[model samples]
Target: MSNKDEAITIVSNFLEASMAPDPELAATYMAADVRITFTGGRAMASPQAITDFNSGRYAWVKKALGPFDWTEHEDHTVVYSNGTLYGEWPDGRPFAGNRYLDRFEVRNGRITRMDVWNDSAEWLLTPELNQES
Candidate 1:
């Protein structure tokens, strides 16, 4: 596998681990300094922080990541990823089909920074997403 391919594999495995409900497994892919910026200016700078934020939201978080479709510019590899994460809230209200697009910058095969956008608006607007609020 080329560098990007390897990165994609790692990214895919990361998502798989999340669905495994193993925070330790899921965390291996993240650099200690990994930085993730969600829309609405919500940023998570630590593996623990990101895990904590997502872990509580649903019973299972599953994603299918592929096609990579990337460009390398200077020191940054701009990659576009489309995938869906499925899970449910703590209340036993099931929510699946949460889709997302993520842009990532990888340095030395380590993800340094990321920007993510998702159709979670659908999740949020749904009666399921609203129940939490």
Candidate 2:
């Protein structure tokens, strides 16, 4: 597989494991010292930290996988996955269609860096986003 294809596979596996509620498993797809930046600009030192933060945000959450857009560079492959989120709030309200964009930097088949951006924060700021349907 080309570098871009490999990066896409690696990221797909990582996201699947993460959405399986197994960040520990997801960590296997990452570099030992990977840097992760979550939505709201929180820098997480580890995958477990990201899981912990998500636990507090919603009772349970998972990524609804989407197509992976990959860019191969001279040094690394960058992959962006755009998707929606589905889960329940702490108050037991279900939420879906929370758009997310995740960017990953892969080198030698391991993700070295990940940056996450999602509409969750914007949803929080816009009360209409939480209305019961």
Candidate 3:
């Protein structure tokens, strides 16, 4: 497989491990010095940190993965994963269609950087939007 294909597979596998809440497995796909930033500029030190953050914000969450788009550079590959988030909220309310975009920089078969953005904050601010009307 091409480098790009390998990068995508690495990313997909990481996501699966993450949703499984298997931080140890997820960390396998990342570089030792990986940089991760979540929505609202929250800097994360490790996959465990992500799981901790998610624990406070959501009851349980999973991605409704859409597509993987990538761009190749001289040294690394930039991959973008866009999709909607679906799961239950802290209040035990189920929600879906919360759009999310994740950007990753893969080098040497490991992700060196990851940035995440999502619509959960907006939904939280406007609760009616998530309500079944």
Candidate 4:
């Protein structure tokens, strides 16, 4: 497979592992010194840190993955995966379509860096908008 294909596969498998709520499995894709940045400018050093953070944010959460858009570069492959989230909130209400964007830097079949963005911060800023439907 090409670098682009490898990047996509690595990202796809990582997402699948994450949806399984298996941070250990997902971390396998990451580089030893992987850098992660979450929504709201929260920075972390590893994939496991992201999982730990999310556990405190929601009662239970899972990603509804969409598609992967890959960009091949000389140094690394950049993969952008866009998706929505669906799960029970801490208050016991279900929510979906919490749009998310994840950018991964893949090198030699491993993700060296990742950056995440989502709509949750906007919802947090607008407290009245988080109501149950």
Best by TM-score: 3
lDDT of 2 by residue, 1-133 (tens): 8888889999999998887778899999999989999977899988888889999998998888888998888999999999888888887878888889999999888999999999888776784885542
What local lDDT does model 3 show for residue 34?
100
Best model number under lDDT: 3
lDDT of 4: 0.85
Model 4 regions lying over 4 Å from their true place:
127-132
| Candidate 4 lDDT, 7-121, residue by residue in tens | 9999999988877778899999988888888887789877778888888887788888898998888999999999988787677878777888999999877999899998776
lDDT of 1 by residue, 5-122 (tens): 7667666666566556576776777677888897566897655566677766555455666466777677756667787665666676665556778777666766777787776556
Off by over 4 Å in 2: 130-133
The per-model lDDT (C-alpha) reads: 0.67, 0.88, 0.95, 0.85
Q: What TM-score would every model get versus the actual structure?
A: 0.74, 0.94, 0.97, 0.92
* Model 3 stretches with alpha carbons more than 4 Å out: 131-133
- What's the best-to-worst order under lDDT? 3, 2, 4, 1
lDDT digits (tens) for residues 1-133 of candidate 3: 9989999999999999999989999999999999999999999999999999999999999999999999999999999999989999899889988889999999999999999999889888998887531
lDDT of 3: 0.95
List the pairs of residues colliding in candidate 4.
Answer: none
